[model samples]
Target: MGTLDEIKAALINLDIPQVQCKIHQGLAEGLSPSAILEKSLIAGMNTIGSRFKEGDFFMPEVLVAAKAMHTGLDILKPLLTAVENRVKGTVAIGTIKGDLHDIGKNLVIMMLEGAGFEVVDLGVDVPPDKFITAIETHHPRVVGLSVLLTSVMPQLQTTIQQLEPYRRELYIVIGGAPITQQYADKIGADGYAPDAASAVDKVRELIARN
Candidate 1:
């Protein structure tokens, strides 16, 4: 197989050593850092997301693959000085208040970064004011809120209400264990994603309209 394809397969197989080796090999063979990242590493992660969605892979597999992707990214970081210029857009994401679960939120962040967006991780148990502060500071084109509990679902609506003033220029997307399109629509969210891969796609789609 080609060098990029080999790198992608190694990542999908969670072969961290092979991923690093291939990254170095790809670079030696005149491949650009950005090419290895977008074509191999990110493509492999996207496949992992699909496998998880299809039940062909689980958390352990996904996490290991993510680790391999990170290893590849670390190796490429120094050579990818111009990565900021390749950013599609900025997205600010946080888990809603009263919800400490960040597994899903973290996965979304990884996917966004892999998709070449500058992600501002707002972290867990984020209150509405914190999100407001982030909007003021980052001025991202899209905002994502995550909630893993049905009880904390109302916080999503509350946060969206607090962000209404910026609604004209910003798109709000919601997701998590208990979040659904119906809930998103009820809360007036601009978009909803069921998984990390979809979140990247949703954010990309939203950014295009901005």
Candidate 2:
């Protein structure tokens, strides 16, 4: 198999060490960092995500696969030029204000990064002003909000309200255990993802719409 294919398989198997070794080997063989990232790591993550959505894989599987992908990325990141890394659109993501939960948010960030987007993770319990600050500073095309608490739904609403005045026509996507499409619509969010895998697809769709 080709080096890229081997890397993809290693990622799917969650073989972190193997993935790292193959990435280095590929580099030694004169493979471009961009080629390794785009053709191998991205492809593997996409497959794992699809399988998770189909019930063919679960969280543990996805987590391990994501870890392996990250391991490979660590090797390639420094080799990539600024221009290449900036090819994908930027994204700012966080758990809504008053919500301490972050597992979901972190997963979404990982998937976003794996898909090539530059992710600015604001961590958990992010206030409306923080979101606004990130948007102003980063000028991301997409903003992802995650809230796992029912009480924090209002916080999400408040965040959206705050963003409206400073908005540059950016796409706002919401997700969490309690978040639904109806809730997203009520809060004026542009989209809602039920899970991390779907978040990647939703963000891609949002990007396409613009």
Candidate 3:
């Protein structure tokens, strides 16, 4: 198999060491860093994401695959030229206040990064004002809110309301265990994702419309 294919397989298999080794080999074989990222690491993450969505893969598997992907990325990041480092867009993501869950949020961030978008992780228990600050400071094109608790679902609506002024400037995407398309629409969110994989697709679609 080609070095890129080998890298992808190793990553899918959660073979971190092999991922790192093949990435170095790809570099030695004159493969550009951007090629290694898009063709290998990102491609492998895409498969992992799909498997997770299909129920063939669980959180542990996805997490390990993400680690392998990040390992490959770490090797390539420094070698990428300025032009090759260009990102598709920026996304600021966080778990809504009163919701301490972050596994879903972290997964979404990983998928977004793998898809070539710069991610700003606002972490768990993020208040609406914090999200507002992220938007003001980072100027992201997309904002992601994650809520795992049914009781805290109201926080999502409150946060969106606080971000109303910036509504025209960015797209709001919401997700998590208790979140749904109906809830998103009711709360005036721009999009809804059922999982991390879908979040990347939704973000890409929202960005494309602008």
lDDT of 3 at 167: 90
Candidate 1: tens digits of C-alpha lDDT, residues 1-210:
999999999999899999999999999999998788778987788788788889999989988987897788788765675655576778999999999988778878866776578899999999999999999999999999999999988888889999999988789999997877887888899999988778888988888884
Q: How close is candidate 3 to the true structure, as a TM-score?
A: 0.77
Candidate 1: segments with Cα more than 4 A from true spot: 30-35, 50-58, 77-88
RMSD of each: 2.9, 4.0, 3.2
**lDDT tens digits by residue: candidate 3, 1-210:** 999899999999989999998988888999877777778876787788788889999989988987786677666655653544669899999999998988778878866776678999999999999999999999999999999899999888899999999999999999997788998999999999987667888999999997
- Please name the candidate that would achieve the greatest lDDT relative to the true structure: 1
Poorest lDDT segment (10 consecutive residues) of candidate 3: 76-85
- TM-score winner, 1 or 2: 1
**Candidate 3: where is the Cα deviation over 4 Å?**
27-39, 46-60, 79-88, 114-116, 195-198
TM-score of 1: 0.80
Report the C-alpha lDDT of model 2 over 113-180, residue by residue, as the tens digit: 75678899999989999999999999989999999889778888888988997566589999988888
Cα displacement (Å) at residue 145, model 3: 0.8
Candidate 1 accuracy as lDDT: 0.87
Estimated TM-score for each candidate: 0.80, 0.70, 0.77
> How does each model score on lDDT?
0.87, 0.84, 0.86
TM-score computed on alpha carbons, candidate 2:
0.70
Ranking by TM-score, best first?
1, 3, 2
